[model samples]
Target: MIFDEFDPKEDKIFRLIDNEGQVLNASLMPDLDDEIIVKAYKEMLFARVADEMAVSYQRQGRMYTYPPNMGQEAIAVAAGLVIRHEDWLVPVFRELGTWLAKGVSLKEIFLYYMGNEAGSNFKNAHHVLPFSIPIASQVQHAVGIGYSIKLKKIDEVAFTFVGDGGTSEGDFSEALNFAGVWQVPVVFTIQNNQYAISVPVRSQTKSINLAIKSYAFGIPGIKVDGNDFFAMFLAYKEALEYARAGNGSVLIEALTYRKGSHTTSDDPTKYRDKGEETEWAKADPIIRLKKYMDHKGIWKEDETALIEQYRTEVDKQFEEAEHFTPYQLEDVFQHTYVDMPDDLRRQKLEYEQFLTWKENRK
Candidate 1:
C-alpha cells in the first residue's frame, strides 16, 4: 500500500526529495548505483550550464530565440538516465538536457540555433528525432515510431515530451487514443511546468491533472515531482519497462515550473507572480540535487570542479560553433528538397541576380 495512492485522478504528488533536500519516499526510490547517481548529477550541471549560456547567447545576438529549461534540470536529466540506448526520444525545443543525455553535442545545438540547417542533421545518431518546435505534434510521431517497433517485434519504447498547453491540442489526444487502441510501445511524457507560454495550467483545463487524460484512453496515468530526480527516474523507468513489456502505453506528467521566459521572444514577468518565483526558487532542482549529493559525501569540492569542467567544454563548443560560416542564401534552397523544383531553382537564380546587381551598383 506504500504507492497505492498513485492514481492519476488523485492530486497526490510523488516526490522523493523534499524542497529541503530530504527524502520523502525512500520506498519508491529507484535502484541505482553510486556512479550512476554521480553521473546524473554531472549531466544535470552540464545541462544547466548550457541553458544559461544559451540565453546569454540569444541576448548577445549570437544565437536565435529558444526556450530555456532552467528549473527543470532534474526532469530532463532523469529522462536521459531512464531510457536505454535502444529507446527513442522525441523532444520539444526546451529539452536540451534530454538531447545532451542522449549524445547530442552542444556544438550541434549551437549550429542549429545559429540558423544553419545542417544542425538538424544527425547522420549517425540512433532513434532520436530532431528537436521539434511545433507544440503537441511530436506525440503522434512518437506513437507512429512505436507502432513500427511493435510491428518489427523489436524491443524498443518511444518517449515523447509535451507541455501543459500541448495536452489541449487534438494531436495529443489522438496520440493517446492510438496508443491505447494498438497498445504501442510508447511513453507520452508531459512537462507540466506550470505554464505554457504565460498560460497557467488552471487556465488550460479543469481536469484533476494532466495525467488523468491517460485514463480516458484506457491506460495508466502517473504524476511525479518533476523537480525530484529520483522520483522522475523511477516514474520514467517503470513507464518504459511497462510499455516494452507489451502492456498498455503510459502517460507521465512531471509537475515543475518554468523558471524563465517561455523563450527569448516572450516575457513571464508580465503575468507571473513575483512571490511565486521566490517559492519555486526554494525548490530549485539543481540545488536540491547538489545538497543531497553533498550530504551523501559524493560531491567533490562541492562540485566546483565538475562545474568548471563543463563550463570549459561549453565555452569551447560555443566558440567553435560561432566560427562556423554564417547561413548562406543557397543553404535555404538546398534544405527544402534534394532535387530543387523548377520554381524553386528559378527563384534562387532570381535572388542571386538581384544580389549581383546590388553589388554592381555599390
Candidate 2:
C-alpha cells in the first residue's frame, strides 16, 4: 500500500508529478480515464477563477473577510473527486473546490460570508457540515459522524480537513484517539499549507512531519505533495479503501503552500516573503494540471473564453448573494440550542429593542 511504502514517520513524501507537470513516477500515476482528467482540470480552473473572484469581491467590500484557497486547490479537488454523495465532508473555512464538487453553489458560499445564515443552509448538498471556524473542533465532529456510521453499519466514510496548525489542538488529538480506538471509517486530512495565518509549520510542531502524529493514535498516515493532484488522488483513493474495509481511519498530510493571504483582512506581505511566494507559485496545482493536460492533448478548451465565462458566472453568483435577504436577528441565537436559553432569549430581545430605538431616532 502507498501508506506502508511512504511512511510518514520516515518523513518520506509521496509525489507523482513535478512542478513542470512531468510525471516523476509513471508507475505511481493513477489510471484515470482521459475524460476524468479533463474534468479534474476544468474543476481546478473553475476553482481558481472563483477563488480569485472571491478575493476580489472581498477587497471591494462586497463580502466579509474571506479565506482564499489559492494554492491549496489540488487537495480539495482530489478529495472532491474521491468523495461520494453519501460521504460526509467536515471542512474548515477553506476547501472551496471540494464544496463545489459536492454540489454546493457559489451563491451559497458567498451568502455565508455575507453574514446570511441561509448560506450555511446548503439545502441541496448532502452530508456536508457547515464550515467550522474554530480551530480543530470539526475534527471531533467528523469522528462522531464516523462512529455513528459504524454503529448503523453504513458504508459511508467521513472525510475531515484541518490546517497544519490545527494538529496541535487538543480536539485533534482527542478525535484521532477515539477514531483509532473505535476503528471508524474516517479519513483525516491535514492541509499542511506551511502556515496557520502568521505562524509557520515549524512553529506549529516539532515532529518530523504532521502526518507522523497519526502514529501516536495507531492509525496509518501518509505525507503527500499536495500540489500534485495525482498523488493526492491516489492517497485519498487508498485511504478510502483502507477505511471502508473496516480497518481504521487514515490521516493524510497534504504538503502545500497557501499563496494567498490568511484572509482578506490580513496582508500576507507582512509575514510572507515575495521570493517564497514566487517559488511556491511555480508549483501551482492549476498550472501543473493544465501543463499535464497540455502534454496529453486533452486540454482543448479556449483559455481566454473559458476564463471570461467563469468570471461572468462567478460575478452573477456574487450579485445574487449580495442581494440576498438581510440577516435576521434571531438567526444568531436560534441555532445554538434546540430550545433557546433564557439568557440568549433576553439578549436577542435586547438587540431587537436597541435596533428599534436606533431606528426611531432616524
Candidate 3:
C-alpha cells in the first residue's frame, strides 16, 4: 500500500522510510525474506566501499577523474536489484553504482578510469552501455533501445539514469516524448541530487516537481525517496512492470542529495555551504540502512568485519590497477575506425617515430 495521498504540488515526494531508519508506510515494505535482506545489505556495503576506494584511488593518481556517489547507494542498488540482467542500463556518468549492480567488473571499471580501451569492452554480457558524460545524450539512447525492444516484441526494458540538470535538456524532452508516442518500454530515472554543478534545483526549472514533467508527455510519473532502498525498489518494480505490460514509459524522479563534491576536481565549498553537507551526511543512505538492518537484527558485527575485509581486497585491486601499462600513443589510432584515413595514418606514423626518437634520447 504505497501512499496514495500524494499532492501533485507537495506530496510528490514519496517517502516510505524516514531518514532515521523508521518506516513511514508499512505498505511500501517488500516481502523481505532473510536472504533478500542480507543480499541488499551486501550490495549496499559493496557500493559504499567502492565509492570510498574510488576516491582514494583518484587521490593516489591510480585513476583518472572520478565522481563520488557516497550518499545515493540505496537508489542505485535497489533499482539494480529490481531489474533483470537482460535489461539494458543506459547510465550517465554519475551512475557507476548502477553499472556495478548491472554486472560490470570492478577491474574493467578501473581500467576505463585508467584510460584503457578494455574498460569499455563489457558490451556483451553486461547490457550496460558505456557511461555517458554529455548529460542527457544517454536518455535518447535509452529511448532508442526501448523502441527497438518494442519493435522486436522483446520483453526487455531500458533504464536511463540522469540528474536534475539533464531534465532541462532538449534530448530529455524529446526522449520522453518519443517513448510516450511510440509506447516504448523504458524507465527514465531522474536522480535529483539538488545541484547541477553550481546551479541549484530551484533555478533548474519552474515546475514544482521533476516527476510532473512526465505528465506533459502523457506518461505516468512518480517521485520516490531515493535514499530509501525499499521505497525505490517498490517504485521501480511497479514502473518496470507497467512498462513490461506495454503501458509505455514511466518517469521516476528520485529526490536525493549528493553528499560530496561533484567530482574529484570539484570544490563544493565554493558554491555550497558546509552545513548542507553535514546535514546530508547525518542522513547518509548507508548509515540509515545499517540502522534499519540492526533494528531488524539482520546486521551483525562479524558481517561488518567481513565487509571491511572486502574493502581491503578492493584496495589491493586498486594497487593492481596501477601496474597496468598505460595505453601506447599508437593504440589510439588503431581504435579510431575500421579504416584510418590517409592523413590520420601518416600522422600516426609521424607520432610513433617522434616517440621512438624521444625514447632513444632518454
lDDT of 3 by residue, 2-56 (tens): 3234544464677776777888878657777867767876887787788888988
Better of 1 and 3 by TM-score: 1
RMSD for each model, in Å, please? 1.9, 1.2, 2.0
Residue 321 CA error for candidate 2 (Å)? 1.3
Best by lDDT: 2
lDDT comparison, 2 vs 3, better candidate: 2
**In candidate 1, what are the lDDT values of residues 1-362, reduced to their tens digit?**
21246887677778888887787777777778878888888888888888898899999999998789899999888888878778899988877777877777888888888887767776555788988888899999998998999999999899889999999999999999999999999988899999989889999999999888888998888888899999888888888878878996888889999998999999898989999999999988888887887778776655677678878899899999899777789888987798999999999999999999999999
lDDT of each: 0.86, 0.93, 0.83
lDDT value, residue 361 of candidate 3:
100
User: Which 10 consecutive positions of candidate 1 have the poorest summed lDDT?
Assistant: 1-10
lDDT of 1 at 336: 77
- What ordering of candidates by TM-score runs from best to worst? 2, 1, 3
Error of 3 at 10 (Å): 4.3
Candidate 3 structure, TM-score to reference: 0.94
**For model 2, what is the C-alpha lDDT against the true structure?**
0.93
Let me know the TM-score candidate 1 reaches against the reference structure.
Answer: 0.95
